[model samples]
Structures are given as structure tokens and as C-alpha cells.
Target: MKSNTPRMPGRPKRQDQDMPVQETVLFTASRLFMELGYEAVSLQQIAKACGVTKASIYYYFDGKPQLFTASVSAVLERARTSTSQILVQPLPLRERLIKVSEAKLARSHGDFETILREARSSLSQKQLDEITSKEEMIHDCLAEHLIKAMDAGEIRRTDPLLTAHAFSAVLMLGIREIAKGTPADKLARDIVDLFWDGLSIR
Candidate 1:
């Protein structure tokens, strides 16, 4: 005779005890969600990529909308942390901005804004707010650095927040046009130079 007991959602049946299963699921989902649009990516695909069952994902996330919000938040937080590090390094503003652009260009991802626009109706106000907050933090990080640059006479005085938005928008456009085999640094320099000419004191 076998015992019939319902399993708890908190403790998932571990396939690999050593692995951080929840983080793994989130990372895999983030990659798929960013590469493919919200509507295109299914929870099953994320679970398959993570080597876990579909039910395992549900244990961690309420549903696809919840998962999408969490996945995008994770991606934005990672980018924010990394970009913060790059901006804080003891480098010229030009070099720092170039490095930032290079970092953005290095990754292969779809236009997240386009994906968000398509998925807007599907996401809840709270979920959208959460994603928007993380994104604003990234922009704010860059804006802080730009403010320092403005004070130091590196770039002309302007709205740091607006400039931050402009730089990100330009990079988003660059991502689509960047040819394979084009050196990241070269493209980065071009972008920085284009802005430097416009933003610098003339």
C-alpha cells in the first residue's frame, strides 16, 4: 500500500540538489523572454530550457504574466548593477560611455520596448509598474554619472535624465543595425563620438 499525500508547492522535487533551481528557471526564462517576445514565449518553453517540469515553474511563478514581469525585472537589475560598475570605474567620461555602449552592443536581444508594447495589454498595472521601476533605476544610474560629468565640464550642461534616455534610445537603434563581425569597441567609439560632438562645449 502506497501513501497518497499532496506535495507542497514550496518544496519542489529537486532534480539536482546542488543547483539553485529557482534562479536557474528565472535566468532561462529571462533569456527566452528577452530574445523572443512575451506572446511568443510559453512557460513550457522556459521549463524545457531549465530542465524542469511545467508544474515546477508554476510553483515558482503564478503564470506567464507574472513570470514575464519577474524575468524582465531580473534582466534590468543585472544590467543596472553591471552598468553601475562600469560608470563608477576611474575612466574618462568618453571612455566610460563607450564602454557602456559596447556592453549594450555585446548582448544579442530583441528590442525590449517593442516587446513591451505588444505585451502591454496582457500585463497588469502592478506588473507593469514593477518593470518600469527597475528600468527607471537604470536610467537614473546613468543620469547620476552624467550629472557628475556636467559638473566637471566633460559634457555640456543639460537634463541628465533626458540625455540618459537619448543615449539608451540611440543604442537601441544601433543594436538592430550592428553588422556581424563589427568590433564592439569600434561601434562604441562611433556612438560616443557622435554624441560627444553634439554634447560637448562648442
Candidate 2:
């Protein structure tokens, strides 16, 4: 989930000394973690991928668990912030929802979920709780947006909370598969069709 690019406000400023290097390492490590589960990857592998010595990586992170946690947290927090901003934008409900969806999927950045999955066993209870809280907030944010759309009759009158979670689940599933491919435009079109028209033989 660690992103190479910054996209939100009020984030901790990165220093010139070693932060960028750490970020670069973390970003690359996140992609590897996503494609290969945590249990399957080694610290030496990550260090090699970063083109740095294992000792150099140790300068920034204590170990794999800490590095993995920090990397995923950075990515997830950014994604949440970006998604929140898009979902709460002052636009038409349908447009806002679509924008929010696009932003969320884009924020996935092709490897966020994979890193998240691989980092599961490395997190402490506190880290797990923090992650869960952020995820729940994201879901709630989407539900609130959906409620607005429902009130405006911009979409069907489904239960906002349920609909939001359902939409997110479906979207993420598609995203996971599409991430391995290079067909973004088609993925977007199919998502829109599924959301607007559903799979009914009308």
C-alpha cells in the first residue's frame, strides 16, 4: 500500500536525508509483497529488489514486520484520505459516487491489496485494529455518500450501508483481477455497466 507519490494534504513531510530512500524501498517492497505473500518473501529478497544491502534496509526498519507494517500503513492511510476527499466532493451524487469509485480503484495502485494481504501476519493487535478502523471508516464514508445519492434519487433505494459494502466488495474483486492485466479502460466500462445496469436480462 505504500505509494511512491504523495497525493494528500497534512501528511508528514519527507526529509531529504533518508526518507525518500526508505519510501522507495517500502514502495517496491509493497509491490513485491502484494504479488508474493509475506510468508513467501524474505528480507534478503526485499533488500535485493531495492538494490541496497540488507544492512542498509535495517537502517530504516528494524525488521520485516516493522517494515511491512510501516509500508502498508503509509499506503492505506493515503488511499483512505484520497477516497474520503473524492467521496465528499460537492458534486452530483451519481457523479460523486463514480468519481469516488474511480479514485478508490486508482488508489489501489495495482498492489495495495496484495501488500495488505501479505502483511496480515506481521501486524500486532494494535496495528490490526488501526487498519480495521480505517477500513471501516472508508466503508462508512461510502455509505454516507450513497445515502445522499439515494435521497436525490440518483440511484436505487437500496440500504445505503449494505449497498456501499456490496459495491466496494465487488469493485475490489474486479480490481484484484484487473490489476494483473493492462486493461484499465475496459475495466472501468465493465464496472460502470455492472453498477448501472446490473446483470438482468431485460
Candidate 3:
């Protein structure tokens, strides 16, 4: 089995001296975006959640566009961290891939997924570009591991990027059903089984 190594991300952006305040705003925005949708979530509403004034939010971010982007990006970073931990373990390629999918499925239930579906209406072109790049980095990480496994013959040889996207798509679909009362463990296991068996078939 090919052992995959985790890639360390670039240096963290230094948090503002007022990081606690920015984090609170981000927290409030993330939850509200999930519940209310981005269009319905006003700066005043976010301020109310953070126990601050709308001006305070503006001091941290230009507007709702940046707020939503920062909030969802935080969640994606968390998911990326979880995936990094999963990849570092000495496991078979298939098992490592399954674990990565399950980690992402857990994250899918959070506010970011809702924000992702809704943020396009609220974010600016710059904000959209930044968030898209962050998400694309995560996809690239998965594709990298797949390529390594394929080269080592630990899994079927396939288009690495396409397989990575397919793996992500299946997990996202499974997570949507899992959110609606299908047990997460059962759904994850069944999805892994389907992927494994399908790969095994000629």
C-alpha cells in the first residue's frame, strides 16, 4: 500500500490584534448564514449576534461579502485540517481515502455548506475568487494523494483529478441524505463499500 504524506499549508495569516472580535463576528455569520441564507442576513443582524454595532463589523470587514467569505473559509480550513490528519496515518490507500471522505462528510453538516450554496449572491468577485481558490486547494490535496496511490498500484489507475472530484461528489451526496436522518456511520460505510466494490469490478 502507498503511504501518503500530508502537505503543510502556507504560513497562517497573522490574526489582527482584535482577533477575538473578528472571530466572534465570523462565528455569528457562519451560524446565521446557515439558518437565514446569505441574502437575508444583514450586517445589523450579524452585529446583534456578536453584541456589537454594524459599524464594528464594518471595521473588521468591508461588508457582508467579506464576512460570509471569511466565515466559510474558516470552516473549510477546519475541514482541511481534519483531512491532513487523516492522510498522515499509515493506512492502505482505499482506507485513507474513505477516512478522508468521512471527515469531509462530518464537515458538510456544518454551516459552511449552507454558506457555499448561498454566498454567490452576496460575495464580490474578489471574495469569490479567494474562497474558490481555498476550496480548490483542498481538492488538489485529495487529487495528489490519489495520484500517489495510483502510481504505486495501490488502487486502480484512473484520472487522478476526476477520481478525486468523483470521490468528493459521492461524499457530498451521501452527506445530504445522511443529514436527513440516515445514520452517518451507516451512510459512510455503505458509500465506501460501493466505491470499493465498483472500483474492483472490471
Judged by lDDT, which candidate is best?
1
Q: Model 2, stretches more than 4 Å misplaced? A: 1-19, 103-119, 179-182, 197-202
Residue-level lDDT of model 2, residues 105-159, one tens digit each, is: 5544444456566677778887777767767777787788777776776777777
Q: CA lDDT of each candidate?
A: 0.87, 0.68, 0.72
True-vs-predicted CA distance for residue 153, candidate 1, Å = 1.2
Q: Between the candidate structures 1 and 3, which one is better when assessed by TM-score?
A: 1
Give the alpha carbon lDDT tens digit for every residue of 5-55 in model 3. 543342122345555877888987877776567778899988887777777
lDDT (C-alpha) at residue 48 in model 1: 86
| Candidate 1 per-residue C-alpha lDDT over 92-122 given as tens digits, one digit per residue, 9 for 90 to 100 | 9999999899998888788889889978999
**TM-score against truth, every candidate:** 0.92, 0.68, 0.79
**Per-residue error (Å), model 3, residue 117:** 4.5
Question: Considering lDDT, where higher is better, how would the candidates rank from best to worst?
Answer: 1, 3, 2
Best by TM-score: 1
lDDT value, candidate 3, whole model = 0.72
Question: Candidate 2 — number of clashing residue pairs?
Answer: 2
CA error at residue 166 for candidate 1, angstroms:
0.5
